[model samples]
Target: MKYIFLLLATIAGMLQLHAATVDTINVRSAQMNKDIKAVVISPENKKATSTLYLLHGYSGNYASWIKTAPHIEQLVDTYGYLVVCPDGGFNSWYWDTPKNNYLYESYITKELIPFIEQQYQVGSDRINRAITGLSMGGHGALYLAFRNQDLFAFAGSTSGGVDIRPFPDNWGMKTHLGEYHQEPKTWDAHTVIELTHLVKPKSLELFIDCGTEDFFFEVNNKLHEKLTYMNIAHHYLTMPGKHNGEYWARSIDFQMAFFAQCFQKVTLN
Candidate 1:
């Protein structure tokens, strides 16, 4: 009898996992004049829930998150929220580049967001919205949230390249901002580390974590220190791992939980 019960329980769990709905949505970006693709994960419950904008790393597409961390489907159902994973473009750095045709920053904030709210049953308040990502997406998440605090109340980054000044030639950032030596001001304006001043004391809640051995660990530490000096409250974590899918998969669990708590508080209020 006990064995039969266990089998039925396992099947029930699998069925619940399959209940979450995943859709590929193409949002038209009027600014960039392109159809940006995104993966939207909606819970089976049709109740009005908050939205979490999840981003991908450098060179990854909208499908990256669902492909790497498939459990996010279950997490969405558990938290009773929607997850939107947007494509940041190949090495676009999620920036409104001056030299390139990529206007991701504008597209995400102005176009895609409005479309999502109009089409979905998610809440449209800052208290009901959040954003986070891995690596380049991490930097993009914080960068966007800091600049647009009215849009997202909670933000997080896992193994993010928060400081782009040090590794000027490493990523394809030069293509967006032009040569680092030639365009120092542009780099400074676009980097997340330099945007610390935009964050007020409690305006934006942040969760930042990086593997101790990750190359971006030092930058994440510097960001934490700067925020500390500014008296901005945030959560900082470091674990034994490297910058890879393994680290992101583990760290996302905590970030989603943090966002869930924030959303729950707003709901209770």
Candidate 2:
């Protein structure tokens, strides 16, 4: 009973890609002021075991992963978990703005997780919660997890822009942190790779992946190298590819699979 996921709606209009088996729900992110498209898929006639916050990268919406990686339904169906995709804002980079005063860190930590737990029957503890994202979001997931260790036990980033000093004009940094050269400390202080050593999370599982051909591979590599130097325990996987939806689409599988395995260990204990 395998079925393909859908992007554009046919006459049925946003129906299940797999014949009404997996539940696709479009919910609005009140903090972000946008509607998020999410999926809750479990084994047929069964409750979900775990939940994952599957974040998308820059210039992409919540539907990016579901559209590109049709196999996500396969992952959700097999693992019996809910995939939560929130709109991180187009090119928002998920950083808490200093001047503009939009606190994404607070929103995701204080609002979203609590709201999700209340609305859904999934386990509200760290064991049943995980976060992973690509590029901008990859950095975001790690930043959020490290800052709020109690909320998410497992976290990962793929082809993440861990270091942001290189791009002063790219993404939403200009609005978030002001000009890079003018406020160099502001930009450097918030970068995930730089802040890794500051976090002494009690119980957290961390992982990262990057493509050798990707433009941001160097930053991700620096993060891996630095984490190793700091003796922080994490899983780092480097493959050969560039920055594209396809690479992220495939990377999502690796991350979600890792999260699922970690959750299995947690449930056993």
Best lDDT among the predictions, by candidate number: 1
Q: Which ten residues in a row have the lowest lDDT in candidate 1?
A: 1-10
- The list of candidate 1 runs beyond 4 A from truth reads 1-17
Candidate 2 weakest lDDT stretch, 10 residues = 1-10
**Model 2 ranges with Cα > 4 A deviation:** 1-43, 98-101
lDDT of 2 at 262: 79
Clashing pairs in 2: none
TM-score of each: 0.92, 0.85
Tens-place lDDT digits, model 1, residues 122-214: 788889889999999999999999999989899999999999999989878887787899999989999999999998778887889999999
In the range 1-269, model 2's lDDT, one tens digit per residue, is: 01111211121342234521455666555655655555554445457657788777888876767776777776665556777777666776777774564666766676667766776678888888898888888888998887778888889998888888888888767887888888888887878877886667446788798888998989888888888888888888887789887787767767766776777778789
Candidate with the greatest TM-score versus the true structure: 1
lDDT of each: 0.86, 0.74
